[model samples]
Target: MGKITGFLDYPRLGETSEAPAQRRKHWREFIRHLGDADASTQAARCMDCGIPFCHNGCPVNNLIPDFNELVHQQDWRRALEVLHSTNNFPEFTGRICPAPCESACTLNINSEAVGIKSIEHKIIDKGWEEGWVTAQPAARPSGKSVAVVGSGPAGLAAAQQLARAGHAVTVFEKSDRIGGLLRYGIPDFKLDKMLIDRRVEQLRGEGVQFRTGVFVGDAGAGSAYDKVETIAPEQLKQDFDAVVIAGGAETPRDLPVPGRELNGVHFAMDFLPQQNKVVAGDRLDRQILATAKNVVVIGGGDTGSDCVGTSNRHGAASVTQFELLPQPPLQENKPLVWPYWPIRLRTSSSHEEGCQRDWAVATKCFNDDGAGNVCSLTAVRLEWKDGRMAEIAGSEFEVPAGLVLLAMGFVSPLQHVLDAFGVEKDARGNARAGTDDYRTSVDRVFAAGDMRRGQSLVVWAIREGRQCARAVDEYLMGGSLLPR
Candidate 1:
């Protein structure tokens, strides 16, 4: 520990964000990391307890206390090494992870937990600035080739690891640009695309080949390799020694209520991706516009928060987010929920910008204003009996709405791809590959991330990717050295 009583002396110092009014102006990262001295002080808050539950809390099993101690000692380079040893993309996680590690900190049981996430942000940012981060290309080629489908966190992490292990790795992305959801799904205000671009550059330097704008199933088109060839499922199995499927959970959960086909109504994923593309300077010829329109975003998760932020950026006249469940308490019970992410109201930075949030409300119908366009939303107050919801009497209300975005979460990976691979799907509609096996029904083809584990956090995706790479390596070499 930096100092025995430092936890008591220096209170937890967290990252600061640009004022909402200022940050809403542009699609840029708003959070700022703490400086050296302040960050060190914050790091000192770690008690460095004997049993660090943080290891369990972090999906990647990041060595938190050691790094916190390193940060506290002002050895940021060491902190970065510790941070990167387990997590391939510390910068990404440091920025967006919910920091369950902090929640499980021993200090959190009695006091504010160590500023693990903020410290991680500072460490990686410092490493990048100091030129400590560099590509570690493989020494000799293993002569084995691997094809990784999808360019999301899982695919990227697996490709990087496999490339470093001397295997030729080529990542295939259907999108025009790589980085998948990171490049298009998430808003720039949360994670800037430039960061992803830099990481891509590093991966390219490590001899990882990225093939974009080529759909895997639709393989007759001219590809970067100048091969207008289609590889059948069996063809891929024969051509490549190993295949990894990391496609996202793209199947959106639909609302099957009446009037669901209204003109102004759209899925949250549909709306968010378009906005991200437009912000990236790709002018969508017929993009949906929230400007001068009232927007109602259904679903109370991060996607809804993203919708709220995007609508504010688009200069919408009004914005509202709806949740079917009842509102949670402002604060979670520490004694009951300690070390585990608890149920509590979390107002994201986007929600803070501008948006009306409602809970315990269910949408009933969407009506058109006789112009073949959505002009209003019909909803009803919900009453919970036991665990079911019932519409409360006299609480039916119609809210004016121009654009209605469905921000509900995804249900599963696209069945087309899964069916093409002949992979078994679990009850939740995800690939039936457990963390232990990491392999699908077919041999040599591995699955990870949302494709295997269902929709989850980027951090979990990274963890699954890394572990899956190790499993693949073990299957190839009988014994492997890659970290799990």
Candidate 2:
């Protein structure tokens, strides 16, 4: 520990964010990173716990205490090195990750946890400012080729690792751009796209090839982008020695209520990508705008919060979020759930942006006003008894909802790609591949990220990508020097 008594001296200090009203005017990052001195002070709060549960808490197994000590000692360069050692894109996780590591911090047992994510955010930002992040090409070529199918965090991490390990790596994206979900699904206000662009440039300099607008399976009507080029699964298997299925789980769950086919109802993925395209200056034939409309976002997760934020940015007449489950406690029972992710109410920056929220309410149907477009939503309040929910009597109500965004989360990877490659699937419909090997049933085929494990956080995606890259490298070269 850099400072033995620092934990007692310092309180947790989170990053400051712009007021919701001011930030909703434009699409850009609103959270301000902690200054060097404040970050060091925060890092110094990392106590010398006998066991660092934050190591296990972090999906990529980040060396939390080591980096904290480095930052506290004011060794910015070493801190960056420690950060990049495990995770390929700390910039992404630093901004979007929920910081489970902080929940698992030892000090959190009785006091505020160390501000790990905020410190990480500052470290990476400083690393970029000092030009410490750059290209690292392999000294020699291994003459092996790997095809990573997807350009999300997982695919990018796997591609970067494989390329640095002396393997030729080409990442194919179904969308017109390189980043899959990171560039599209997420709203720009949370993460600036320039950060992704900077990493893309670095990867290009390191001999990684990015093939955008190329779908690796049947360009089916469901989730494939417009004007995408189709490449058969067999084509990739034939061209490359190994194929890694890093394509994310894009199959969204549907709400099959009456009038779901109405004009104003859309999946979150469909609605989110268009805003991102517009932010990037692309002209859309038709844009889904929430401006001056009564917007209703369904779901209680981060995706739902993003919709609320985006709607607020669009100057919607009103924004309302509905969560099917009952609200959680304001404070977690830390003694019962210490060193683990606790069940507690989490209020994101978006939730603070003037959106009305209701819990334990289920949408009954979308109401139409003579026209084909949706006008309002009918819902009912529910009460839970023995883990079963029952509608409360006389609690039915209707709210104006000219626009409805379904943020219910993704169910599985698009089945077309899995079917095209003939990869076996688990009960959950994700590709059947064990974490130890990450090899699919098909020979020379591997899976990782949301494709293997179901829809998950960006941190888990990076962890899977790194481990899958190691497995693929070992399979190709009989051994791998890359970390798991």
Candidate 3:
């Protein structure tokens, strides 16, 4: 409401980015946040709608209009405060989140929605540059302790909140590094790792302890990392008053077709982590490189698009992405789905880097090159009727590929970890925990993020983590001042 008619005067302005050809040469963030002037103009477009559906649209229920008005009024410091009040890591979400809030904007019914995400990106970055972002240690200690398993967004968010609530928080991570998925699963081109490092330091200043290379489960539970010290679930339950299992879903959905055992076929997780490790200056004896190879990434999602960008940077001969489902409409029926997330075709920056994308095609089998390596794949076109898919008659085709990366998304959390904790699981194998209490069946155990809700967005992970922290705090102190 900073400018009553600003929505009619201004159009949506997205952030600028480096050209694909130039950006593909290196592994670094290429997209630049909006400048102060552009951000203010964009924020001005926030219409004084009676109800802010963007609040419900955002997983953290970010005060979008409040920050937008602050930015429009050129109050950068206040805007950052409003942003950090809800989102623990706006920088991460600003970079990777899909911005469901924008889709739910009141002005989005017909005109373009305001650039809320970009404004958030600007506000946080400016806060850091101005030294406005700092540690907020608790004034008094609650004397309670918490053990958080997994150091991803959810676990980190929970640790930060509990620590600020005057509880001693220790975060356990299987990897040698602090960030779990953020440190490995995502490419540096999309999000710079230094951002995570700064936040880690901030949390450390707030009295949160990070125990890397420590698996909080059985040693034989098949942790991806080696040389990690295993701590039994019972030990954590005894050492700490409460435990929060915020470990993310890591079980990748596999394509169990013929020749799945081929050498060139790998899960996106395995391939992606190696590249990130290499980028972090860790040399690997054997790395999966898409260099000069015809790479076929199965699954048309953000992960697949990431593969495309990474492959392009690796100088792949070609990159092709496949989707089993039919393509969505470029533009959604906004009137029908206004104030809600609409299913529309989304083209990520990576997709624009150069990728041949196909939809409604299912891989039949991987063709072998006679050396236990994948050479090509047989696929069939499919048609959907009444929510059922049927293969088109005699439409099988073969595409040459030296590498295949499965990016079909994760199914659930590692069952062994949950089993070690002896927590009950839901039908989908996620830890059975209600949002209100976030308590697992086991005493003093809680679950949040993907561990409880199955695989989801980063923003949802943060929301669950914050709420889970409040639940744990209340369980311990019999009352909590922390927000849900």
Candidate 4:
């Protein structure tokens, strides 16, 4: 609440980006941060609504109104303090989160909402610039230990909160690097990996131990797997005060049609991680080059966008993305969908690079050339009737594709890891853990993140991790000062 009339006086102005042509040339963050004047004007748009629905919209329950007022007053330091009181990594949420709180803003009912995400980004960025972000490492150790499996936003948030709550926290990551999806699945241009590295450094300085390339169980552990440490659920139950499972939902969706096994077909995960490793200096005997090859991406989510970006970086001949459902309206019916994510045709930055996007399309089959490589792809158009897709007759077509990347998302966490730990699973196949308590069936063993919530946003994962940390602390020592 800056000025009583600020909502009417100010219009929303968020961050801008460099020209798409220039940004696509290299893997680097391209967002142009809003200036103090711009940010303050945007913050002024947060109206004096008695009931701030933005709180419910934000998974971390950030005190958004107070921060808006402070930002309007140009009080960056206090704003960050209030922001950090609930969220462990405001800097992270600011950068990658989809900002549901903005949709729920009072002004969004009729006018453009306050640029909440932009203000959040500016607040945390200014805090770090002013060196206000530092390690508090708890006043004293509680002599408790927590093993958090996964180094994504959720795992990192949980580990940081538990460590700050005076518990010894160790985070385990199966990949060679940290930041599960954030590190490898996402392209560097959207979120420069350096941000993650800097946060990891802060967590390290705060006494959180991170062991990368360490498997929690046999799910991802191949025969030649070397464990930095073995973690049996039984042992974790006995040795540590509590164990929190925050591993990702890594089981990728696959296509089962004919010729799928051909050389050119691959999953989005299979293609994405390899490019990430190559960027990190890992040598590839034969690069998975998309250069001058006609490429097709299946699924129209963020992962597909990443495939598009990486393919452009690889200098592809052309890129096409297919989605099964009908195309959404360019603009959402905001009056009906206000305070909730709306159905709209969301175009990503990758699409700006270049992509032929088609919705209401279903992949019929993959046809292979005699040499056992994908040659032609067939698709059929669909019509939505009674809330389901009905294929349109004679609307079939084929495209010449040298490569196809499946980005259809994941179904569940790997079965073996859940099986090995003997944790009960929900109907949806995620580890069964309640948000109210975050406890799995196994005593003192909690679960969080994608491993528990199914495929979700990075911000939700961070919220679960923080809440799980508070739950573990409560279980270990009668109650917790940690924020839930």
Clash totals in order: 0, 0, 0, 0
> Lowest lDDT 10-mer window, candidate 3?
218-227
Name the runs in model 2 displaced over 4 angstroms.
Answer: 221-226
Off by over 4 Å in 3: 219-223
lDDT of 2 by residue, 1-484 (tens): 8799999998889899898889999998999999999999999999999899999999999999999999999999999999999999999999999999999999999999999999999999999999999999999999999999999999999999999999999999888888889999899999999999999999999999999888887866754453578999999999999999998889999999999999999998888989999999999998999999999999999999999999999899999999999999999999999889999999999989888999999999999989999999999999998889999999999999999999999999988889999999999999999999999999999999999998999999999999999999999999999998
Question: In terms of TM-score, how similar is model 4 to the real structure?
Answer: 0.96
lDDT of 2 at 71: 97
Candidate 3 vs candidate 4: the lDDT winner is: 3
Q: Model 1: per-residue lDDT, tens digit, 1-484?
A: 7677888898877789999999888988999999999998888887747899999999999998889889989988889899999999989999888889988888887788888889889999999999999999999998888899889999999999999998889888878888878877899889988888889999999999988865666443343323533445666678789999998888788888777898999998888889889888898888887899999999999888889999999999999999999999998888889889878899899988999999999889999888788999899999888879988999999999999999889998877678878888899888898798599988889999989988889999999999988888888878778999
Please state the error at residue 482 of candidate 2 in Å. 0.5
lDDT per model vs. reference: 0.87, 0.94, 0.94, 0.87
Q: After superposition, how far is residue 93 of candidate 1 from its true place, in Å?
A: 0.9
Q: 127 in model 1: Cα distance from truth in Å?
A: 0.8
Report the lDDT of model 2 for residue 90.
95
**Candidate 1 segments whose C-alpha is farther than 4 A from its true place:** 218-231
Q: What's the residue-level lDDT of 310 in candidate 3?
A: 94
Give the clashing pairs for model 4: none
- Model 1: weakest 10-residue lDDT segment is 220-229
| Per-residue lDDT of candidate 4, residues 360-477 (tens digit) | 8999889888899998799999998898889999999998899999999899987778887898999989999889889998878899999899999888998898888888888889
